[model samples]
Target: MDIESQNSPQFFSWDSLPEQLKSILPLRHSYLIKNFNVLSPFQTTENFEIPQFELDAFVDIDDKEKAREWFLSFESKSKTTMPESRRYEIKGKKVLFREKRHCIHSKLVKEKQGNRELKRPQSSRLRNTNCAATIHLRLELCNIELSHPLEVNLRFTHNHVVNSAESLSFRRVNGEIRGKFLELFKDGHSPASAMYDYEDALYLSATDEQELLVLLADRATDPDYDYIAKLFHKYREMALGDRNGTSMFKRLEEVVNDYNNSGHGKAILQEYDSRTGKAFILCVVTNLMNRVHERVLQSGELCYMDASASFEPLNTSITLLYTSCMVGALPLGLFITSDESEITLEKA
Candidate 1:
């Protein structure tokens, strides 16, 4: 682009910008010049005003629901469905909408002369060169009872020129989409899977996945983790029921029994501390591991043993014996113990 063209007050195509610059661009263009320095000598010197679009104007008397519907219609149209729209006073009935990005305020520093004199160092509170575009909505409600009809008013304002294409791309989960997500959840798909499904259905960007999930969770009346856990428990219950309802320990025992029945291993040995009467060590050396044990024995070098406290399920420790061989490091034996004490190590 020529210097004159670069300096012109012309709109730049969103796709033409590099990926690194896309994120810094504001949703609107009014604050663009103030937030960024124009290096071109012929750059536009005139002040540019942000354009405003009046979405709706309505006053519902004794019909709060109708007024809310009208307000939400504008919200849905603009696709400004971020969770940052907050209800300030439930009794007073007011909702405030603002940009989701937080202002990265400059750190307060004490003056060199006086420690008490603290000051901010920058003209802008937000980090980097991006304009913190302030797009907001204020909904006020007057009166509660039917004695006098409730007065409702919504005012939408923005400090930047709205990007039509980008604004339309914002996600707003309507009833149909929300119902689809709930149906997937009811069908036992995980939250992550449900989120992917929603994203796929709408062709949403990966950056909006978390925001979409948050919106879904709000509609579902459950937190994301809780919803995921519920689905997991449901599937786990089904699996357990199909397997004759065996507990985790019982399943482990069944595997050990099968190994013994096949003559591949003997019953696991349990050694208890005589004074405490608690099983301190549980050792197992299966027939499959016999070759490894023999190799370690033939090498005539003491096998290295290490005990890890993190592996066991029931607050126990696991000890493993390994030896270097021609093939590689071979595991000689496995031991599970209640505690990694001298007695337990000696017994293993």
Candidate 2:
């Protein structure tokens, strides 16, 4: 942590730096002009549809909840701060909730400045697929905000067949898979690594090959790394807080945000260097771990503990408190310490 080591230029490869990489995807104006016709949002006085899909017509329904159910059916997620399946617009007495589902393989939206495309040196997350497959819901509010007739627009004419292999991108991830992925990611694993580890973990946890296949049946046709990688980054920012923060205490603070409390929850034990106020001996035990350890103790099972030094490149020692299970050793507590001293060992 010295100034000389920090300022060293030999720490990384030249090609791996942010400046060396191609930052932005250049607008494919030629392909856009040739393959598609529509670009800007323009409507005529005759065609007064909400989403303005050319071939689709709006359906009328009386119930507002049914309109919401229609929105959720598409698995349409929110691109804005609004929750999924909850986008709406209010005009006078008319209360409108629109659900627009775009084709996954649809053409990319352009970033235009005036008439020309706005080409930037940096990367952008702004997306407009220009896909026609969509739905729009419109409803009117009577006096005292009473229920009125609802209008549902249909443009489910996706460019690709729904059951086709290319359309697999449209499949929604179930809560189980999403929760597991988030858990692994929050435990300091990369997207690719976490995926691989998850598969291995599943395989190891299952009783046999048959059981493994049964567990992985739903995930057999799951979207690959390319699609999940984008979701991973988004989940990291929203679920897990800023991963690039310089403060170690801030990270510990984030960890203890929910997982740890004075009352029976995840516990964090630490030994800090008085000079720098930096935690050198850090041990974390989750609620699950506490429950497992308690079970082991209650069952009068022989528990095992071990300390391994310098297994990682972080110049720290790892202390593991585990018990043998049917499949493998179940880790009850994990500790990362600067040294394998008596104080650190006691804390672990």
Candidate 3:
């Protein structure tokens, strides 16, 4: 390896030449020697010239890690010495796509006898009409903290019923957060205690970039974080408490079943990468129940609790979601409902 070749101008990006040269100097001389000069002593000029001999000295440094380290070291020094504007380029976030829809609640009223106006309660009407929803989610990576950890925040709003056809209505829900850190750790086989740093935890546990974003969204904005975290703790403790307990067995089966049915638990467990590495997932599937019912008997105090709870708490243990651009199964990207949003990361 010729030292001269390592300094070539041809191989340097416009910004790299100065930084690269800084790395070659002895640490003590580069930092401590205030008045020392490599060329002429006691001569100072604000402007610096690129040396012809060093122009062709740039060599291929194939190790990206080493290059990054050198670049960062130079950057740190520049931050202190250079003016603020020239220190670094701040990457601006560009909106990828935005879909907006208006939601208006409609009363489910049977044709009244004659042309008299019929009255109905909004709450009861809300429960009676079978709502089919297509939630639009706005996603933006507003800020990214390099090295230490990535912080993501999601701000959302909603419109009521967009379209209602027959028994189904299409609309978006804007205020629910569906994922948690515990899920990320458990599904990725990482201990919850290992999550001291959010960014590193993400890099270690999330295989796909989308999943990473989803996980961050879950951590930062999901309102149900505490509830989910509690559930995870209880679930984990129960499993460890009795390996063959009846409750454990039932829970495991439910997790597995949920995964097969594209349920919330399973959605959180799937991951994919579009271009880089194979991804693992920790999906936060929400709005687990959607019902379509006929108006049967009229009652003032009917207990409308989950009629389908019997088939609930699905098995989501071995579930995974794959990303496909063409005609494929499974919902892609982010989907929001009138009450909640589900963020899933697929590694491509």
Candidate 4:
């Protein structure tokens, strides 16, 4: 993806940029200069050629903690200012923070599904801009005090105009708000009710979404109802234990442990494809499922399966193998798989 060789690279001296592009990076530098006795001219040396940007600016920070504080602010500000930026950890020492493209330029993905262009993404504010604006930080462990300053860099050219209002969907809802919504939901309040309940206990909007769906909102302010709905869906997935990802699987395992301890069900197979990480396979025969399965075997009753691809957060398909008898269609065993291929299912 690094087409820097084709972009006709342009380099501006760090000193020249303070006056030229100062408005582009409005806030971070003044804070750095005042606190860190900032280097007058950030030496750009060989320019640590990276394919990310047509233009790059480098700065040094002697104080690791302050630099971290600045980083925290910088990242938080992106939620409303440009796009919700995500950090891609490079090895363990550096991070490349870039804007997400919101799965916008996806024509190529249609041609190649393996490209994962439509996957869980960090969306960008504008599409096809290939916006070369980024902030790369050479980091040190924050847990302990470190002597050397981490190298910080930024890319200043944007092919499109940056606007805060365009990034409203990328706004992050705080954990407190999500937790409160979950509590209200668990108490049987609908998503709309949950939002109202949260607001009743906290901030009050003249209209239902007056405060939310704004250009910017603080922790005290609620997020758009869509975010709340997404959280509800996420909660269902976690409870179902069908979602993929290492963290999600670990949580599902906790649920499995609880199920086993309660003597309610036994998880015969709890497996994931570690190599490709594209599949989640689990087989569970609950007490009810087992009883129906045994009755079908003894009575030679009709057995059928229902397949559903609505399993969320991943492409896992759930197939319910059930037996029909006087008691009705009862599940014998649950089959969850990512592969819908004939050979794979036949093997299963």
Candidate 5:
């Protein structure tokens, strides 16, 4: 019998799969498998169990190559010539770079008296194997249809649809993002002290645009909970130095700058600095307030009050704080002092 002919798709079925996969075939093949399992033994398996071989119920193609070939044969969908490899067939597949190299070998050691003895072991052969063992299967394309028609081709600055959709799908859970960064600047915590963990968290979470936005939004706001805000104020006040010396604004600027220069925060820093950003920071704070309140309500902590009423105070506070910074700073030409203008401490 010819080897090529022996390997043909015909005369091959689930029965022909490897033993490991063949064990799973009965469960897959039984039409009543779902209902059968529902009549529970009241037990759950910890590991996933897949049949050794399964017929391609959705697609007619058996082999990955055949699937690739079918996609390649399609007429040029565009004016441009299509490449030999088609995207749909190859999108998530990984081709082996080279044959496996033997790096580590397990050895059995037997100790007799003071000396040790090494032994080679024998292995059992697999029997009644099925096609599932030999053939690696792929996930069927998800046949998802949008409930609402997407007008993706529209010309708009920043493309609202794309941005909105991405924001919905990819936005980080607000509490998680806040808790992570707060872990760094935590009471008495500085980047210098927590540099190792800070670098790791920054690299891991901040790389994605949505995550970057989340962290930036988190740091760019004052704490929301009344208690937390009071605590933050207390800490800041305690850290503040005596009159004529230390400024919290300068210190905050340095800390925020440090956060921005590291990993993903750099992009956020650039975007915020390039644009009129106070409003964006306000919006982020609003997002946090709404998100946290929703979570609290879900957990039965607080009844959902009017979000608008809750947000107004924060908005006012943010504006007042920003205004204080702006109002206090003296322009170069407005005031000049070379230890010339001085105010004496009034002993009250």
Candidate 6:
């Protein structure tokens, strides 16, 4: 027979197929045949218990995007992916896809003595098996209308025995667990704290640490700090908004320069050295500080000036001029200097 004719479904029976071809059949098919007399014509009349192969019931989603999101969520839990060789097929409004994954086993066996051998063979690694398990997702239109919601069906098929403890799907956070995490996050708990609470609620051993944190961070309203930092470098204009389209430090410099040039009746003082002609002390009273001066004049006679190390860990001091206001003591002006010397303070 020609290659195509030999491979045709009608051309060969299961018993007549070559051992290599039969071995390549899906793992679940073997399990089905072993558990049920599905291939035997006479046993078709007999009633047999069929094993359940569904992990979750069909879910109805609003749109294709929502269906994809649901499938992704399921895939995340299962840690599996659709085979690259097979493309997802769409028929009418229905989409069908399958995910397959491999299984690995490790074991240690005692060494066996061999005849006339100097030493027995030590324990060796065993071959890994591509456990031909599969998860099928079918998304179909719920109604005759094309715009109707999609109904998603999830089915699991496995040929090998499953150890529930080792399964990713079993360890993954379910809807209930995710809902609790969201509630905690909305209540102002940090991702780390929320993950801790989730573990505590489930009495889980603290072995898996990062999964919950990653999931919560992905769903959080605030952009992750690392992502924001990356965006600040890559998309500086968007990250800074309307702040002169400059980086954070450059924007601070621009504010200082603008205040110095505006001339708002408040002093913009700078003292240069007589020898080097280099600026030694520079301080500016901004337009906002000028308004604060007016408020200080109206509020009280007593004013306070204090000098201390700057909040940031630097060799600089911040001098603050405060006045009593109706809302309590408020700073009228701020001066930052390289040193707390009397000469620098006088210039400020």
User: What are the per-model numbers of colliding residue pairs?
Assistant: 2, 0, 40, 7, 11, 0
What TM-score against the true fold does each predicted structure earn? 0.31, 0.40, 0.16, 0.36, 0.15, 0.30
Best by TM-score: 2
Candidate 4 per-residue lDDT over residues 1-348, each given as its tens digit: 121223322333334343433333335342222111122222223343222132232334445466655555544443322332444444545432222322222233233345555434675543343444555555444522433235445553333323235433434565556777888766657677887777665545444564344423442245677777888777756654455556667766776787778877777445566685534566677887766656566434566878899665567788878776666676777777777767546545
Query: Which lDDT tens digits does candidate 3 get at residues 1-348?
Result: 123322321333334335434533213211111121122212114243322112112112223344333333432332111111112222435432223221122121222124555353453334222112112212223311212111111111111211112112111111232234445545643333434443464567888887655544432232233444565566566554443344554664567576758644333333223355433344333332211112222212232211111222322223322232233333222221111113321231
lDDT of 6 by residue, 117-150 (tens): 4332572422222333444444554442433233
> lDDT score, residue 119, model 6?
33
Worst 10-residue stretch by lDDT in candidate 3? 148-157
- The C-alpha stretches of model 2 lying farther than 4 A from their native spots are 1-66, 74-89, 98-104, 108-131, 142-148, 170-180, 183-268, 271-279, 283-315, 319-335, 338-348
Off by over 4 Å in 4: 1-72, 78-128, 140-148, 159-163, 172-177, 198-222, 237-348
Error of 1 at 236 (Å): 9.0
Question: At residue 336, what lDDT does model 1 achieve?
Answer: 84
TM-score of 4: 0.36
Q: Give the poorly placed runs of model 5, Cα more than 4 Å off.
A: 1-173, 190-199, 204-348
**Model 2 TM-score, 2 decimals:** 0.40
> Between the candidate structures 4 and 5, which one is better when assessed by lDDT?
4
**In candidate 4, what residue range of length 10 has the lowest lDDT sum?**
31-40
Estimate, for each residue in 1-348, the C-alpha lDDT of model 1 and write its tens digit: 211223423233445433322333222221111012222232112343533321111122245464445435534444333233233444543432212211111121111124553244653322221223222333344333323232222222333222322222233336555456567766657667876665565445335766555444342322234444555556545433333223534544665677679877665645344475556556777775686666456435757787788652357788787777677777778888877777667766
What is the descending lDDT order? 4, 2, 1, 6, 3, 5
Query: Cα RMSDs of all predictions?
Result: 15.3, 20.3, 27.3, 15.3, 23.5, 16.0
Q: Report the C-alpha lDDT of model 2 over 276-334, residue by residue, as the tens digit.
A: 64457666777777778777653246568787876644568877788887767777878
The global Cα lDDT (0 to 1) of model 1 is: 0.44
lDDT of 6: 0.42
**Model 1 pairs in collision:** 28-161, 29-161
- Per residue, candidate 5 scores C-alpha lDDT tens digits across 111-131 of 112243323235232111111
